[model samples]
Every structure is written in C-alpha cells, then in structure tokens.
Target: MSSLHTLLVIASLVIGGMAGMLYQKRRNEAENIKLNKTAEDIMSRARKEADEIVKEGKLESKDLVYKGKQELDREVKEKKKELSQQEKRLIQKEEAIDNKMSSIEKKEEQVARKNQEAEDKLKSVDKVREEAENLRNNMINEIEKIATMTREEAKQLLVSELLEDAKIEAARELREIEEQTKSEADKKARSIIATAVQRCAPEYVGEISVSVVNLPNDEMKGRIIGREGRNIRTFESVTGVDIIVDDTPEAVILSSYDPYRREIAKMTLERLITDGRIHPARIEELQDKCKQELDKHVLEVGEQTLFDLGVHGVHKEITKLIGRLKYRTSYGQNVLGHSIEVARICGTMAAELGLNEKIAKRAGLLHDIGKAIDYESEGSHTEIGLEVAKKYKEDWRVLNAIASHHGEEEFKCVESVLVQSADAISASRPGARREVLESYLKRLENLEEIANSFDGVSKCYAIQAGREVRIVVEPDKVNDERLVTLSKDISKKIEEELTYPGQIRVTVIREARSVGYAK
Candidate 1:
C-alpha cells in the first residue's frame, strides 16, 4: 500500500511540475511580445523625427537662398544708382570746364584786338609827331633865313632880349613879393610874440650886489669882530667876503663880487652869530660846512629848475654850474632869473612855432650857463659855454643854440633861432637889464654917426630907442635904386660895427621935388 501511495504522489508531482513549466513558458512569451512592441514604437518615433528634421532643413535652406538672392539684387541696384550719380557729376564738371574755356578764349581775343588798336594808335601818333617835328624845323629855318642870321645867332639875340625883359619882370615881381611877405611876416611875428608874452608872467628879480644880514643887537657886531680883529680877518680870508659893520642899524653888510662867496660868508656869519661861538677855527669850520651845504643846495636847485622847466639829463658838474647861476648876475639882472625867464619865453614861442619845447627850454636855460664860471675862466661866456657844452656832450641843437645866441655862430636849427629870439626878448624887456647912461647915449650917437658917414645922407636920426635909424638922402646923389643900395650898406655897417640887443632897421628916404610956378 505504501508503494501505491508513493506512485500516486510521484504522478501528482509530475503534473504540478508540468503545470509550473507551462506557466513559466507562457510568461516568457508575454514578456517577449511586450519588449517587441516597445522596440517597434521606439523605432517608429525615431523615423518620424528624422523625416521632420529633413523637411525643416530643406525649408531653411530654401529661405536662406531666397534671402541671399534678394540681398545681391539690392546691392546691384545700389551700385547702379551710385554709378549713375557719378556719371551725372562728370557731365556737369565737363560743361563747366567748357564754359570757362570759352570765356577765356573770348577774353584772349579781346585782349589781342585791343593790342592791335593800341599799336595802330601808336603808329599814328608817331607819324603826327614826325610831321610836327619836321614842320617846326622848317619854321625855324625860315625864321633864321628871314632874320639874316644863323640859328644859334638868332637864338642868342632872342635870349639876350628875353633875359633883359625877364630881369625887369622878375625885379618887379620880387619887389611885390618882398612887400607882401614882409607885411605878413611882421603881422605874424607880432601876434606870436604878443601871445607868448601874454602867456608867460614871471617875477622880476631885483638887483642886489651885497647881502645885508640883520642883527638882534649892535653888540653882536663886536662879538663877530672878535679880539684884535683876528676873527674878522679870518672870516674874510676864509669866506673871501668883506664884512662891513657900520652905523646901519642892527645890520652888517657882506660885500663880494662873487655872489656865491658872499652867500657862503653870510651863511657862516649868521650861523656863528646864532650859535654864539665865534673863533678862527669855528669860523673856518662853519664856512666849510656852509660850503658843503650850499653845494648840496645847488644840486637840489638845479634838479628843481629842471623839473620846473621840464628839462632833464644834465651832467652833475653842469647842474652845479646851473645852480651857481643863482648867485651870478648879467647886466645887473640875476643870471638864474634871466635864464628861467628865457626858458619860459622860449617854451612859449616854441609851442606857437611847432618846435620841441623841452629842447628849446633846455637851450634857453643853459644859454648863459658859462656865466657861472666866466669869472674863473679866461674866455668870453660864449666861448667858455661852448667848451663846457661840448665837454658835457650836449645835443648838437643845444650847442648850436648856445653858440649862436649872441651871434657868435650861425643858427643851425629853428630851435636855435627861437632860443636867440627868446633870449633877446627876455633881455630887452623893460627893466629886464640895466644899462649905464653913458653907454646908452654912446650907442645912439654911434648909430647916427654911422648913418651920417654914408655918402648920400643929408640928415640922419636914430629913433625908437636906437632900434631904427632914418636917413634923408641927397636926391641928386641917391636915386631910388641907390637908396636901396645905401640903406643896405648902412645896415651892413651897423651890423659889423655895433654890439646891440635885438635888430636895427635902417631906412633911406630919397625925394625929388620941382620948384612950383603957381606963385
């Protein structure tokens, strides 16, 4: 029974095994089918994607080609437009060039035609000139033949006659011109002088040869005299001035020809009196100190004078000389005052005459600079002044003015003449200078004597303060022509023989009268 049971179990086991095997086989087959389906779907999707990709690529390529073709056409069209514009511009430029060439050709043609006309005109003129010249020659020849003389001889005769006629006409014209010019010149000169004089108003300097120092009391005089008169002697020796203690109340007189020395002496004495210290050493000390102070003062004065006159750049020595002029006198007029007056007058006249006022003023101021040293020097003021000016390398015009102011040299410039004129104006003004009675009378007498010494003078008189001389000439001896000659001779003689300020006028009168039968 166990065997049979075992057999049955075995059989059941085999059936179950078979069943399991079949189930397993069926599962395998289903899995294989699912895998095949999944593979097929994946392959189908890949093919569809590849085909879409190919279609998009072809469309993109076509669009790209179409865009490229459009761009090329646009570029070609722009190129054509640019080429057309260039062509148009070339045409316009060609037309303008052609117009300019035609205009230039026209101008050249006109120029050629005008040149031909000018050549023809020149030829005609040459022909006319030749004909005129030939006619003139023929006329000259005929005249020479008719006159029974050669050409040169007839020319000489005609020239001589013409010369005589010209002389008379020229003389008449010259006389008229002289009269008119003299009148105008006199009027103009008077106007200018009057204007200048009106413009300048300077104070007149009083002439004082000695300096008077006032004292506090007469007792001071004895103190100045000192013991044994040694102090006065020392003062005089050191200062080169004379001290006069006289009855003049409370004043002592200081006298010296050298005003500069007198001024120093005055300063020293006044200082000594003020300080109440009087001695030989003290006097000399004060004198030297005063001299130094005066020298410094002199330079300051020169600088001030230059500033006042608008003049500059004088040498230091020359400036001192200029300051020294303050103490000097000319014809009893203060030299410095006179120089200042002359400078002002010169400046005024120079302004009116349109000259350099500074140069004129400078020349005027320094005109009498030599008078400062004339006492110490050997020559005349003019000569010494010239030497000093040249030494200082003054302007040529200034030198000329200085040299010619007194007629020692000829005037080289208008400024020089103005300087002389101003100097004369300053010196000749009323009360500007002092003259002795003897000299004044002698000058007038000499002037009359000079006029009388002339041959044709019947009577003569020096009038107008000896500025003018009138002469009555013998009618038979001096004709109108001779009157001119005699007047010039008298003037020349006066100029040579006289030393006078300003100018002298010589007038000659020639009159012829017939005896009247009316009685």
Candidate 2:
C-alpha cells in the first residue's frame, strides 16, 4: 500500500511538471510572435521614410541642374553680345584705316610730283652753274696771263707779306702784353707770399737720429752695460737702436737711423736708469711700457695737430701717421713744423683767393704724409701719399693737392693750386732747408750747364743761390722772337734734368750793337 501511494505521487508530480513546461513554452511563443510583428512594422516604416527621402533628393538635383543650365545660357548670351560689339568696333577701325591709306596714297602722289619738279629745277641750275664756272675759269686764266703769275703764286706772295706783317704786329702786342701782365703778376705774387710768410711764424727744432740721455753718474753706464753686456745687447736688440756709452762725462747716446726707435731707446734707458733695475726681463717690461706710453703720446700729438688745424673726420691710421711726422725731419727742418707752416699758409692763401680754406689746409697738413712711411714704402713720397689718401678715402680734391703738390700730377682745381703754392712757400723760406756745400755747388754747376747746353747761349750765370739764371745769347743766333723761346727751352731743360727746391727764373739777354767809328 505504501509503495502504491509513492508511485502514484511521483507520476502526478511528473505530469504536473510537464504541463507547467508546456504552458511556459506557449507563453514564450506568443511573446516571440509579438516581438516579430513589432520589428516588421518598424522595418516597413523605415523603408517608406527612406523612399520618400530619396525621391526628394532626386527632385532637388533636377531643379539644381535646370537652374545651372539657365545661368550658363545667360552667360553665353552675354559673351556673344560682347563679341558682336567688339566685331562692330573692329569693322569701324578697319574702315578708318582704309580711308587713311587712301589719303596717304594721294599725298605720296603729290610729293612725287613735287620731287620731280624740284629735280628738273636742280638740273637746270646745275647747268647754269657749270657755264658760269667755265667763264670764271677763263677770266682767271686771262688775268693770270696778263699778270705773268699764276693764281697760286699771287696767293703765296700775298700770304707771305701778310704773314710778315702779322708776325711783327703779333710780337709787338705780345711784348706789351707780357710786360703789363708780368708787372702785375709779380707784384701780386710777392704780396701773397710775403703775407703768408708774415702770418705763419712756426718754431722749428732740428731733429737728429741720435738721442742723448743724461745720467746721474758714470756708474749707471757700467750698470746699463750689464754683465757680459747682456743688458745692452738685449735693449739694443729690442729697441732696434744702439746705445753708445763712451767717456762722455755723464751722458749716453742712443743712435739709430729711425727717430722713433731712438726715442724708444731713450725712454727705455731713462726708465731703467730711474728704476735702477737693469736686466733683460726688466728691460723688456719697461720697453713694453714705454711703447704703450709712446703710442698714447703719438695719439695725443695727432689729436693736437688736428685740433690746431681745425680738421675733423681723419682716419685713425691717418691720424697716427700724422703724429709720426712729429718725429720725422726733412733737410734738418722738423716735418711737423713744416707741415703746420704749410697748413697755415694754405689757409691764408685760400682765404685770400676765395677757395675752400679747410680743404686747402687739410691737404697741406697731409701733403707730406708719405714722408712718414717713405722708408718702408717703395715709391716716391707723392705716390705714397696718393696711395695713403686713397686708402683713407680722402676727398678727391685733397688727393689732387697731395699728388700735385710736387707737380707729379696735374692740378685738378684751384684748391690744389693753392696747396701747391703753400707747400712751395713753406719749403723755400729762408733757413727752412739746409743744403750741403757739395750739393749746392753741384746744383749751381748743373744750372749753368743746362743753360749753356742750349744753342745761341754765349754765357750763363747762376745767381741768387741758383734761383735765377741769366744767359747771354748771341744776337746773330737768337733774335728778339727767339729770345723768349730760348729762355723757355733752358728753363724746361733745367726742370727735366735737375732736382732742386723752389723755382728757377730764366732770363735770356740778347743785345745787338752796331759799331761805327767817326774820324
């Protein structure tokens, strides 16, 4: 009984569970059908909306195409209208050209007719002229036969007489003109030169290649000589100067060809003497210090020169070179003093002559700059000066003055002329330069020789310290006309062959005497 009950209960539970499963499956199937219907409806609506959107897009595209075509057509019509207007203008221009061509052709025909008429008139005139020329020639031949001279001979005789008369008149006029002009020119030149000299009175100190330094005692000399002369040798080698310590009481001589080197040695010796420390190392140290001091001194000197001249804008190197002139000498005259004198003279003369005084003075101050470096340079002072001026980009007028101050170049302006005259005045002043006896004698001899070399010169005398040469010419050999020419020739020969300062005045004397005895 208990097993039957248990079996029946299990069978019931199984059947009930199967029924519940079938119910759950039926509910799931109904839910799946509902989800499928809802999905199908959503897909149908989406398709309808998409179809409508595509139709709208097609319609919009067709409208845009139609509008674009219409705009294109309108543009084409406008272009056609513009082209037709241009064509009309071209047709009008062509018609106008045709009319101009017709007018030009008519004018050409008229010009051709006129040209023909002119040719005929020219031909007739030529015939008449030929006939007249023949008649004239016949008349000339008749006249020549009667006169017993050809036309050319008559012309030559007339020309000869006219030439002789002209020469006499020309000579008389030239003599009078020269006498008048020379008198005025000489007076003016004297006045200018005298004024320039009077205004500028520069003090000059003669410089030599030896510098003497006074010592406290002779013991200092021995000390300067140092052990084994090492100190002296080192100083000399460094300074490029020789120290001559002889029995000169209490003085030592620093000798060198270069004034700058001599100066350096002098300074170095003075410092070493004062410090009382004499050795190679001390000597070099003091030498370096002295060089620095000298450089400062050089720059100060340059600045002072420029300030004195009232010049500005000089290159640094040029200013240094100018200062170097302070230690330079020419013919025993201080170059700096001479240059200052020249600058003053140039300024004065320029003021008097209505020229640029500053430019004149500037050129005058720098004219001898070449002499500063002439020892190291290969050319003449003028050439070196020209190069220096060019290097510094100096004014062209200043360059001209520098180059032509020695007459090495042609004067380019009145300022150059003024600078040249100033230089001459400064260099040629009394006591400005010292010429050795030998050179002076040689120069005088050369002057006389040059004068005597020319023909018609009977005798010549170089007077006024060779500043002037008076030549006696043979009156038979040189006439009054040739006297002027002979003087010029002798002057030219002197200029070309001789080298001298200042200028040479050539005077040719031709005197004719008729000797007669009244008995």
Candidate 3:
C-alpha cells in the first residue's frame, strides 16, 4: 500500500511542475508582446518629429537664399548705374578734346595765312626800296654833272655844308643843354651860397704886428725899463719880444714877429707893472708863468673851438695848432676868425646840399692849420698842413682838402671841393684882403677887357667889384642861342688870361628891339 501511495504523489508533483512551467512561459510571452508594441509607438513618434524638423529647415534655407539673391541684385544695379555715369563723363571729355583740337587747327591756319601775307608785303616793300635807292643815286649823279664837279668833290662840298650846319645845330643844342642845366643848378647853388654867406658874419679886426699895453703912468714905464734896462732886457731875453717904452704918453708898445711871444710878453709886463716888482728875477718869473698860462689858454681855446664846432676825437697836437691860429694873421684877417667863418659857411652849405656837415666843418677848420706855423715852417701852408695831417692819421678826404684847398692838388671828394669853396668865400669877402686901389682897378679893367675881346660882345662892364662881368651882345652876330656860347668863351678867356679870387660870373644879354610909330 505505501509504495502505491508514493507513486501517485510523484505523478501529482510532476503535473504541478508542468503547469507552473506553462504559466511562466505564457507570462514571458505576453511581456515580450507588450515590449514590442511599445517600441513600435516610440519609433513612429520619432520619425514624425524628424520629418517636421526637415520641413522647417527647408523653409528657412529658401528664405535665406531669397534674401541673398535680392541683396546681390541691388549691388549689381548700383554697379551698372556707376558704370553708366563714368561712360557719360568719358564721352563729354572726348567731345571737349575734339573741339579744342579743331580750334587749335583753325588758329594755326590763320597764322600761316598771316605769315604768307607778311612775306608778300615784304617783297613789295623791298622792290619799292630798291627803286627809290636807284632814283636817289641817279639824282646825285645828275646833280654832280650839272654842277660840273666830280662826284667826290660834290660830296665833299655837301659834307662841308652839312658839317657847318651840324656845328651850328650842335652849338644850339649844347647851349640849350647848358641853359637847362644852369637854370636848374643856379637856383639851388645860389640858394646854398647865399644862405651860407648870410649865416656867417664874423668880426673883422685889423690886427697889427705890434701890441700896445697902456701903463698906469710915465713912472711905470721907467719901472718896466728898470735900472740900466735890466728888467726890460730880461723880459726880452726870456719872452723873445721887444718892449718899446716910447714917448707915446703912458703906453708901452710890445713888438714881436711871433704873436705868441708878444702876447706872453704883454701879459708878463702887465702883471709886473701891477705888482710893482719890476726886476730881472721878477720879470723872468712872471714871463715863465705867463707863458705856461698862455700855453694852457691855447689848449682851452682849442678845446672850446672844437666844442663850439661840435667836433670830436681831435688829436692834442692838432688842437694845439688850431689854438695857435688865434695869434696868427693872414693878410689882414685873423686866421682863427677866418677858419671859424669858413667852418660855419661850409657847414651851412653842406647842410643845404645834404652832405655831412661835421666833415665839411672839420675840413674847413683844419684847412689853414699850417698858417699857424707858416712863419717857422719851410714850405707852403698847404704842404706843411698836408704833412701834419698825414702824420696825425687824418681822414684821406681831410688830407686831400688840406693839400688841395689852395688848388695845388686835385680834389678827391665833394667835401674837399666844399672846403675849397668855403675857403675862397672867406678869403674873398669884402674887407677880407688888403688890396691896393691900383690893383683893384686893374683887375676890374682886365675883366672888362676879357669880355670885350670876344667877337660877339657889343659892350661889357665889370661890376660887383670884379666879381661879375655883364656883356651886351650884338643880336645879329650873337643870336639868343649863341649868347650862351659867347659868354662861356669870354669866361674861358678871362680864366686863361687873368688871376682873380673866387669865381667870376659871366652874364650875356641879347636884346632885339623893333620900334614902329602907331600914329
């Protein structure tokens, strides 16, 4: 029984096992089918989403391509418009160039036509000139034959006549030129000279070789002569001046050839007389002191003269020499006074003529410097002055003025000429020189004789103290045109024949009178 029960149990266990297997298998199959369906749904959804994304991408791409094409078309249109404008400008420039070329060609053709016309006119003119020249030559030959003279002789006669006519015409032209020049120059020159003369008015003193010192009494004269003339001897020995205690009242005369010594002697004697100590020792002491004072006074005068002249940078020796001029005399005029007057006149004229007044004045002042020592010097004042000036390293212009003021040398500068002119004006003024009546009259006669010697002069008169000659010209012989030449001739003759101071003015008067009665 137990074995049978065990077998049934085993069979039941087997069937249950098979049933559990089938149940597990069916569950696994259902799970697999559900998993398959889920996969299919997910794949379908993914494909739909991908298709929509592709369609949207295609639309965006198409829109971008359209925008790009529209932008490209706008740029291409702008390029075409710019190219059209450039083509129009090029066409206008080509038209302008063509017009300019046509105008230039027309002008060139016109020039060529004018050139051809000018050439034709030149040919006609050459033919006419040749015909005229031949006619003139024929006329000349006929004239020579009719005159019964050779061609050379006829030519010579004609040339002589032409030369004579030309001389007259040249003379007329020269006179006109001279008149014009004189008319212009005379006005200014006269003004300058007149002004200079009017401005300079120096005092004229008749300086003599002797100086008179008035004594207190006749008793003072004897004191000056002292005992045995010891005081007078010492004074003359030291001062080199002769003291003349004469019978001319209470005055004693100091005589000396050297003005410097005379002046010092005068001062020394005057001081000795005032002090009442007229002795040999006192006389000499006073003389030496007076000499030193006079020397110092000379320097003062020099410095004062330069200061008055507004001159500077003068050498001391030159200044001393200038002071010495105060004691020196030329003719009857004081050399210092004459020099100062010359300086003033020169300065005035120089100012008017627009030159350096300082240089002119300096030259004038130093012009007669040698006259200061001319008594002691071996040469003329000009030579001595020139040597001194060269030694002092004066200006070359100044040196020339010093050398040539007396007309010994040629002038090197305008200022030198002015210096000479000033010197002449000073030396030639009225009462400047001591001329005898005989010589003065002789000079006037000589001047008139010189003027009358000219052929065309009808009458002449020397006036203004021989400074000017006025001539009456024969109108027939010397026409108004020839008067200038005649006057110049007379003046040249006067210059060549006579020796006169300053300048002589020649005045030629030509008068033509035709009188008719109205009744």
Q: lDDT by residue for model 2 over 1-519, one digit each (tens)?
A: 999999999999999999999999999999999999999999999999999999999999999999999999999999999999999999999999999999999999999999999999999999999999999999999999999999999999999999999999999999999999999988987887788889998766667778899999989988999999999999999999999889899999989877876787889999999999999999999999998898789888999999988989999988988888888888778888898899999888888767788998899999999988898899988899889999999999999999988777899888888787787677765566766678888999999988888888899998866777999999998989999888888888888999987578798999888999999
Question: In model 2, which range of ten residues has the least summed lDDT?
Answer: 428-437
Q: Between prediction 2 and prediction 3, which has the larger TM-score?
A: 2
| Candidate 1 lDDT, 167-283, residue by residue in tens | 999999999999999999999888888887787757666667799999989999898898989999999999988999999989999999888888999999899989999999999
Model 2, residue 466: distance off in Å is 3.8
lDDT per residue, candidate 3, 424-496, as tens digits? 7788766876666788889999888878877878888987677778999888888787887887788889889
TM-score of 1: 0.65
Off by over 4 Å in 2: 1-167, 434-519
Which prediction has the highest lDDT against the true structure?
A: 1
Worst 10 residues of 3 by lDDT: 428-437
Q: After superposition, how far is residue 429 of candidate 1 from its true place, in Å?
A: 2.3
